[model samples]
Target: MAVILRYVDNKSQVIERFMGVQYVIETTSSKLKESIDEFLKLHDLSYSNLRGQGYDGTSNMRALVALAKKNSDIGAFFTMTNSLVNVVGCSCKRRDALRDKQQENLMKAIENDCLETGQGLNQEISLKRAGDTRWNSHYDALISLITTFSSVVDMFDMIVEDCYNDSAELDDCFAEGNTELLICLARLSPNDSFVAFDKEKLVFLAQMYPKDFTDQDRSALQDQLDIYIHFVCSDNDFSQLRGINELAKKMVDKGLHRTFAYVYLLV
Candidate 1:
């Protein structure tokens, strides 16, 4: 399963946005793609300006993301994780075993059904187990499916309960919205809509720190930050970079002053 979140500049209109001209937030599965794509398309948003991709570790997502980044207008930077233990651990072996056990229980139900009344609940336990197998199996399968895509299932429930209020606002925009990709681009890219972070923070510090610390602490720190932002840090680095001014202050205090370099990083 792979999920991609196409980040709109928050300031841009739906119509002015291009198909790939947006910031993208990605997760490890395609399970949410259909819904997300539907959400965006309905709003007349294009993914043209996609500058980032984020995801948890998974071969399917990694391959597809690589393809998207290379071929699309997305930024060169990508964010991915090695693994999401909680999600994967639940879905891997343990879930499969539970499913098998459920199937056996359902089979027992069917066998008991035939020994008494029909497969209906009113039947004696024996008869219920007879024909009940099929029904039980069906129910179990449904439950198992839910467990498998639990994250998405949770999201769907939220969407339903909300009555798509956010979507409604988007729908209003869509009604008056132009279909041009560039127009949509404009809606998503507003400065007010942009996100910022504090580089002084640990997360940003990790990116700004030097990979190879030397006796010369400042040079080492600058090198670390460069390596981290460029190669070491994953997708989280971009989305999570902290305080531009504060980060600048530290860098300047350290003696490596290059505004263009940082700007190049952001763009």
Candidate 2:
């Protein structure tokens, strides 16, 4: 860390001069004081010239943190989600097992007339592992995990039957109460108004509001919006929306600012 000495020069103007940086070997308050004293000494400066000082200190001892780890539902959810993802995504073989199992389930659903068939419906979709800098990655990972849940728990069951390795990626993946956590998170979702794709969805819905579009026009608008979102979201320039609500408001203001259109109600 860099340390600077603050003092008024001979010109009577306050000036902040850059002092040399020192590598800190210890972090205790006494040790930090010693380090500062040594730093001043190296510059042939005296502590008597010091007027004010700043030091790192805790503001309060309260630990009112999000996802408090001391035995809460949120902590359990985090632990369960993390452990399950680690166990399932640990190897390509396990991931393949999950996909195969999901495919089998999908086939059964289609046979029972529970799921509709379409061109891309049977294509393979696999698990997503979460990353550090992205919260949405965790949501995606959790969705995949839930979709492949029964198959994954079966794998965990098999692992425990053979030989469970507590230190390995399977740690706590098969814990009994995790199902509740999974169900809870699966039902919880952020409001659609803030989702990036939701702006187009809302606009399409507004176009169907009986004032702007007929039935045929609504379907056409839906297809057009789908294609447009697919194109823009794929392009690097329009992808990764960071201000969806602001953009939605701007669009509404542009179209329905002074009009008696029902589209203004959509905003």
Candidate 3:
């Protein structure tokens, strides 16, 4: 397990320091927690002081994709796309043919003014193989298909007999609650002077972690959030802030970290 510490330093800068990784023999809740506790203790820290926690478990995104694949149409679409990549990428000769065919189509399109010619425009590229671990790879593969559609179709036509092929430690409650929490988190977006900010939803999020936020903290969070939103929105320095990272940096830079401790934790 990898550990990272996010804290505000003496210079009022929000710093995310890599604490290191702890090798765990088991990934069960108790074992993982014990390992993390020991790891933090080694660095003179404890869970009591942990204001915010985030986990990048392998199952989160992969499981979501798996759930989506339960739909027959989505499942077949990805299978077909993967098969296309396998057939075209299995041989160097096939890859070269694809590049040449794509180039030929690019040239025709440019000549017909269907595509603009430029230094970087219409650069030859091969199909990308999508991986199960990262959903973005599938997105990239689909994009490549869009650019090389005609080439892929032509290649398949030439070989009508060609064969085809195919390929967060988020707990059950967290997984089931993801949709609602995600929608609430979206409301915490830093864009447009925190226009999407919702105090109730944010407090709801904080309340989910009773170990981190006590009754007093939960009550104070409401007032803190109000002040936090007002202060950030009214300030010109935060007007152009785009995301959570930028907002965090800006908060530290302006020394708001010291003033709004609870708000910064929510951030």
Candidate 4:
């Protein structure tokens, strides 16, 4: 389930922002819908307030799209535009079909290898156990010499191969699944619960920005972060900021605005 928050300026320009995401153990869309409704009701929000929604191009979101079509203001967009990445990571209809076919072929290959291990000429019970545990050590060597290799290869050859596969790119989007970059990120920022950036990539982006940030821009940036952290941590009405009487109270009171935000279940 996901919660989307829409930020509207005084001029009424609506910019949708991602507030939070919650992973559910349920597999079906119906069950997921029920869970989402329960979560929103707990936070005192109704479906009527949602402005825009982002989704992973899944069946659940597909159902949401159909339901949302009945509502004029709701905007739902499928987020995965890259096909290569979708092949491996997508839970969408077509991509899932390809993954299932690949799994069937892999199981066939493993079974054929196991049968060859059973018929080994030097196959003592202990030696067979050793071979069973050490399949990688002898895979190319023993499997190459085996007659079953030709059939297994032929089975794989018949399937349409995805040469320029983008699954690796899509899988890289998840920080935990990509090992090398995530490892370096963890080392660089040891205190963060999860590292979302690679140092080199971040360094390149930082270099592209202007060296000097303007005073107006800096003040706006500070208030944005300050207000965001204050709202998330305290869960109090933003109207309270205007009512505070202390140092910088006059400054804080000016830009403060009463806004409605989704109190999402954060990880």
Q: Model-by-model lDDT, in order?
A: 0.39, 0.57, 0.78, 0.39
Candidate 4, poorest ten consecutive residues by summed lDDT? 258-267
Report the error of model 4 at residue 93, Å.
38
Query: What order do candidates take by TM-score, descending?
Result: 3, 2, 4, 1
Candidate 3 deviant stretches above 4 angstroms: 1-57, 161-267
What C-alpha RMSD separates each model from the true structure?
Answer: 27.7, 26.4, 30.4, 29.5
lDDT of 3 by residue, 110-151 (tens): 889898777877777779876776555767788899889999
Of 2 and 4, the candidate ahead on TM-score is 2
Number of clashes recorded per candidate: 77, 0, 2, 2
Off by over 4 Å in 1: 6-39, 47-100, 108-267
lDDT tens digits, residues 64-112, model 1?
A: 4454556443322111111222332344443344444444555665688
Estimate the overall C-alpha local distance difference test score of candidate 3.
Answer: 0.78
Clashes of 4: 2
Per-candidate TM equals 0.17, 0.33, 0.39, 0.20
Which of the predicted structures, 1 or 2, would earn the higher TM-score when compared with the native? 2
lDDT of 1: 0.39
The candidate maximizing lDDT is 3
